[model samples]
Target: METSIPPPKRLKMLDATIKRHQYQQDALIEILHRASELFGYLELDLLLYIAHSLKLPPSRVYGVATFYHLFSLAPKGVHNCVVCIGTACYVKGAQVILTCLEKSIQIRAGETTPDGQISLTTARCLGACGIAPAVVFDGTVLGHQNPELVSERIQGWLQNGTN
Candidate 1:
């Protein structure tokens, strides 16, 4: 789908930060961080804006964004669930866990719910292998997940925001 790419806007606060840092190339990371915070995700226009302001190439900005797993090109969900697909989690049946979640939530990886309440995705590793079959809701990690428990927990989050 071809979405409209809006023109870039100059963010005064980010401009000031860039100025304070003397527009150092190293400051790109910091600038992108602030931009992500302001806009929720690193949209293409925002990337172009940063590139123009910093006199950097759009490709360079995109490269840095993609290099970091924390940066997302798409809009984030109000609620997010990240299941770990690391070897440990996989061995513990994380695939089954993810399948149950997909069925219950009715959204696949890299997609948000129709109401935009949740986005589901899988991570290569969360570095918490001791707790295999782990899923992270928002930023909180839930370990040792079973299918029923995963469904119930997601439902609870939708209904009560307990997660």
Candidate 2:
């Protein structure tokens, strides 16, 4: 008798996405987006599977994943907070907001909270320069942010336990 282990359901879904894209190397970015959507974050093993499935070099896949700010190799928390440090935002005091959040949460950029409740990260640009000093909280971009405003928002999350 012969038996084979079945792949995890999520992996199967990722495979389907790859198949839908015809496994074309040029479709890498789209496939990666789907994979990230399905997996929350792209771990090394998942990236390897993708590289192997597309017959591309692991290094190449890794490079692509790392090159894009949208891709995250590490696990994200329930609530995501991304501070934009673009020139416009910086000049508008985005750095001060970021610093306040870090001090309030006791976690640096790219690090998740100890409780896994929030993930703090920074972005080069969110393309909302007109609103400069923008911050993204749980996917909703809030513009013209200040340190006090951000701190209050973080407090609400901490107290309400909401994402």
Candidate 3:
């Protein structure tokens, strides 16, 4: 069974974080970052509360949160696999790696595994063009990635805690 924090507790924590930052409207991005870090994702209620506390329009808050790729409104898994899909990475066959991973885990990109063990996401770029086709697995950037290598890494991460 997974231990989870209640919604009210999460809201309180976010409120505290906002208060600590003085609830400045200009601190919206930072507030969202802290919220996502604490709750794993920003739910609708949290978004609304943030907008209300900031004295900003909900649309503005939502737009800012959605405009940035760093903020996630969906739940993430314990492990995250982010494949770079930049021009260099694409030229190096990043899509092949993504497809292979999807086949391996039976979950497409932007989705989490059924067991909630892993999540697969794609990035515009990981800023590793020299070592193109980089994939960030659990925050570790592995460049020069290929389908076979990515598959092996995924399998290893599944069988072991980390790789």
Candidate 4:
């Protein structure tokens, strides 16, 4: 007979969050936010757990998780790079900056590097239009960016290592 291992403490915390929300279906987004906070990313098993707990269909749970860009189905790397491609940033050559990163890192947008050192993604708008062609490196918003500067920053992360 196989013994069952108890779920992680985070799972229990998620349960508390669900309970706090009274399991109302409308609170699905809030529940998911807490789940993601407890877990770095939303694993399939966790989503299923939430669905079962809320008495929601698995499809609905999956749909909500995928619908929002804020949630990540997969784990993120130690360092994260999010580029703003909103009208202001795009018009200022955000695409060129993104392309430079892809070529240098050999990974497309919304993908993490093979070694998991960095995860690259794009945001529709960071609300920093004044600084067009903006990129967020490790949560720090950078403005007036260029391919050379972005490349240099990434190279620095690769060489110096990120926390």
Best model number under lDDT: 2
| Ranking of models by lDDT | 2, 4, 3, 1
Model 1 Cα RMSD, 1 decimal: 4.9
Error in Å for residue 123 of model 4 = 0.9
lDDT tens digits, residue span 2-69, model 1: 12423233366667778888888889999988777666788898789788888998999999987675
Task: Write out the backbone clash pairs for model 4.
Answer: none
lDDT at 68, model 4: 77
TM-score of 4: 0.89
lDDT of 2 by residue, 8-43 (tens): 777788889999999999889999898888877889
**What ranges in model 3 sit over 4 Å off?**
1-9, 161-163
Candidate lDDT (C-alpha), each: 0.82, 0.89, 0.85, 0.89
Candidate 4 wrongly placed segments (more than 4 Å): 1-7
TM-score of each: 0.80, 0.90, 0.85, 0.89
38-86 per-residue lDDT for model 3 (tens digits)? 7788778878989999999999999988877667777887789999999
Candidate 4 residue lDDT tens string, 19-93: 999999999999999888878788899899999999999999999998776788888888999999999999999
Q: How far is candidate 2 from the true structure (C-alpha RMSD, Å)?
A: 4.9
Lowest lDDT 10-residue stretch of candidate 1: 1-10
